[model samples]
Target: MHFDRKNYSDKILIDLYEALLRPRMIEEKMLILLRQGKISKWFSGIGQEAISIGCTYPLQDDEYILPMHRNLGVFTTRKIPYSRLFAQFQGKLSGFSNGRDRSFHFGTNDYHIVGMISHLGPQLAVADGIALANMLKKEKKATLVFTGDGGASEGDFHEALNVAAVWDLPVIFVVENNGYGLSTPSNEQFKFKSFVDKGPGYGIDAVKIDGNNVLEVYDTIRQLAENVRKNPRPVLVEAMTFRMRGHEEASGTKYVPTELMEKWAKKDPLQNYEAYLLKEKVLDEATIKKIRKAIQNDIERGLEKAYAEEMPKASTATEIADMYAPFEQKVVQPQSEGKNKKRYVDAISDGLKQSLEKYPELVIMGQDIAEYGGVFKITEGFVETFGKERIRNTPLCESAIIGIGLGMSIKKQKSVVEMQFADFVTCGFNQIVNNLAKSHYRWGQNADVVVRMPTGAGVAAGPFHSQSNEAWFFHTPGLKIVYPSNPADAKGLLCAAIEDPNPVIYFEHKFLYRSLTDDIHDDYYTTEIGKAKLVAAGENLSIITYGMGVHWAREVMESMPELSADILDLRSLLPWDKEAVAETVKKTSRVLVLHEDCMTGGIGGEISAWISEHCFEHLDAPVMREASLDTAVPFSPPLEQNFLPKGRLQQKIKDLVEF
Candidate 1:
């Protein structure tokens, strides 16, 4: 598998040798450290050094690469200081994620690298997002992303390829078919002949190469990447290689056959490549020895310095502050009030329109959200005004689209993603909870993306479409949840959510979209995110609610004046107004938490627990909760009406007041 020596310069040949040698040497040192308990784990990439070094060497500084756990060459080749990377491996304060993430789990924007999460598939789609940014900016940049033979089996892999092909995005997917996933053989992982064979089904160009051959990997990837950057389409390169050691240092390779291991050992990437370099007279034995000695010295110094660095402190205040990016909730009241009445849906449209006009970096993505508008028609006439590039319609792949938006955010592009229905978000739940929610805290990366959720019940849209699902994301940290009750609040809260430098879940009640109307300002204005609005103030008892529950409480107050109480609407759920809740609780000495979600695991439980713990002395009665029945929303109108908390709100308020 020797390549022609005449095709490459001496510098390129020498540079490739250095790249391949560094990771193998580093991994060897790290394994010794792991045995001494200096580091907790190591995934050795001894035999497959050629794939990472070759794939990474061809890319420019501005182009991005997303690498997996075993791709140690990505970090070393990118010229990240060896000391800081060792500190990251040791969980020291000086690491890239400041000790928040470890090993190859962390990413640095400075190196134009995105690191993989333990769930490997999401990063594939995330690469699409990076390429998407390049396409929108009209930049001739290609995104290279890596995944194992095991990871290629994930749904996100297919979705990512389809998305890149459909949009004609420049993304080079490098599948390192290392013949095993952990202890599972590649034969058990997929039925296809090779990953390259499946590329045509996605309309992507494909190639298979000897991953153990450094020359072939470098030349093939370099040439293919050039074409992709020029033409802007996804291409798959299957690099056939094998792991020379266990998946992790701790996971022994007993499951692998002895003959197969021996067979792969003969084709060792670094060993064979180094032999060819010496044979071709690229470097003398003295120079080779000098290079090895230099690499070993660097590794020793890096580990020693990293060990001396201080460990990260577990300060409560600092930890809490680091959970979300700093955001100031400010309510900008209109200078001159003018009555421009509109339905809840219309107000959301206005807010999005204004956001689009205000921020040129803003892009909206969803299924049928472009020329067809959204299923709910929230983005009607938007594509005509904003154009398809900004008002993008995405595939039915929810996970890929969400991950794509996160990728775009990484490139400083603000994105607004509309979940076709609140229930449909389950498909993208891992991306939201695992990737998006953990992005900021994992690194200093701000996921400045708004996820528009059309939520709530009472429309008889059945179990799948009509459930009140705000509670799902409310429990997850590093996310902002905003649920508005009326048109003005809807418009204002949406504006605030879009501008906030955090991942915001903006829930628009499907039932209230056309049912409610109010006077919204013609000009843009923002309602404070964490501030609660007092719809009706009274002292008998307090009814704390949000979204449709606000209207339900208002109805109870109007119908039964005897149940006079302070009705506080908590517009934002994550950083909900604790001060206002305390004030109302202390004022009335009684509280009733209400929501449209099912009674058992709903937000009402968390609210009541907090009230019980913090405002214990102020309570004249136990904190009461009124929520929908703990069952799926029914299709029958009668059962649906009975399932909602609105039917029993008056009685719940009466009991709280009487107590």
Candidate 2:
């Protein structure tokens, strides 16, 4: 706590003290609000303010911090207006996320800080991406990311650290060892002698610091920040501190030992810092009280405004559709260079290639994506063309790979991440649904990412390789799901997905990759999203499908030419154009919705329900749904065929038509 007066300016010392006080006061007011029932819940950082405050010193204009829930003091140090902060926590319209999210789950792009969600593990990779972006842009700026001991143990933590080190990214990862991971003690969290030891293993330089000592923490961060900016290497700094309270107010340390609580109370960062300042004659008692009073007054002022601010309307939660609104913005009416006959796989590759030509900042990454061109050879020659920086070959870590795209998209890289197989998406489901899908709604920023999911079966790739997993993403909000059935739609939709300003789940049918072929436009153009294609027109009935289902429906129609029906290819499901669906359903009174996924929870159910609700008067028969059985996609060719909707689709349509 002692510092030479000549070495450390009195102003710096006072600023650090104020930084600690601001968050403390905010947290105290939050506790009061929670008790009053004005705020629903709060994750109190309480005694751990020093780490959030201390490490934020000497922040440059271009620099940004990715903070955990506990790091409210980082806001104080970054000069985030108390008005927005208060409004955000209060779920008011003025909140950073427009009250779309609560607590530390909001962030502001203008403020240069991306807030963390409850699953904060993924943000490490995200921070690495932001830093990678700045490095790619040659910006002399760094991103500082904070995490707790619990988050440090997540898979993303190691993945991000290794990637950061390998890339020599300018990221300073600080782990706040606050004694507990929401009730679990430090001894139970890690067996390691020091968490800092992880740095050297990952090829990152690291250090452990006194988190409670504001001056020491600040000086360490300040010095390391210099090394990060100048040398551009990922650095790990573990800050030893204590929560000194339960995870949140509700927990109340009922399970925590009283003696352990007492032990940390004696080392309270606030009291110790005040005592140090007083002992060093750096701050008089009157001056200290005045500073504390000022911070309290500011908190009161902000809280009053927040209380007066209007809460978001009931409709705030609904209409959470594709972020790319008023679709005219992404219209690409580029000149076409005749037609080129291509397979579905090559068409998608062409789309990616053309997307890169248009979006200079576009990058694609996945397992064996670079040199090997992926297992399907869809990304073949992409690495050689885009180079390793743009076309990255990632390790076999789905969570980290998807997390990298989640971060890259936020950094404006317009990333396209391919899952080796759609079934493997389970590996990174947390990042996909929680990180990529929730980014726009939670942060009010553009997280334009295209996750190319090669879904569906025909390849007999078994349960772990082939899956009609569109149902999973269809249920999640804030994602644009595009499933193209042919080469033309695949090319155009993939192109549009890349340019669209939102997180898009592009499902490319692995079965149709090499099997399907068509002469597609060899020009830079974008297919309209949310709009379905009328593959064939008929007035007797309507057969709505997407992906491999389109082909199945087409084949059925060829045999049953008498049962004439309009085949509607719903290119995308998340933002399925309601108007288009209703028109088709109304025109052809009997409607059959089909999909390759299980019948129980398939997207066919949603479409069937919607048609029954919206086009009820126009219906000649109850909306029919034809889909695979509620079972895993079997490996055996016979079981797989029976598991698919294709075989039963014809009979189901006949039954519906007769009915």
Question: How does model 2 score by TM-score?
Answer: 0.95
- lDDT agreement of model 2 with the native: 0.83
Q: Give the lDDT of residue 174 in candidate 2.
A: 94
lDDT per residue for candidate 2 within 1-659, as digits (tens), equals 45433478878888888888888888888888899998888888888888888778766756878999788888878887788888988888788877778887876777778888888798898888888788878887778999999888888898888888888889999999987888787788889888887877888888999888787788888888887888999999999888866787887787777887788888788888878888988899899889888888888888888878888776733545423332353657659569978999989989999888888898888888888889998888887788998888877778877777766766678888889888888988998888887777676666778888888888888888887888888888778899899998898899989888788899998888889889888887888888898999997888888888888888989998677889999898988978878998878789988888889988888888887887899998999998888898899999999888888877898899889
Superposed by TM-score, candidate 1 places the C-alpha of residue 323 at a distance from the truth, in angstroms, of: 1.7
After aligning candidate 1 to the native by TM-score, how far in Å is the CA of 264 from where it should be?
A: 0.4
Best by lDDT: 1
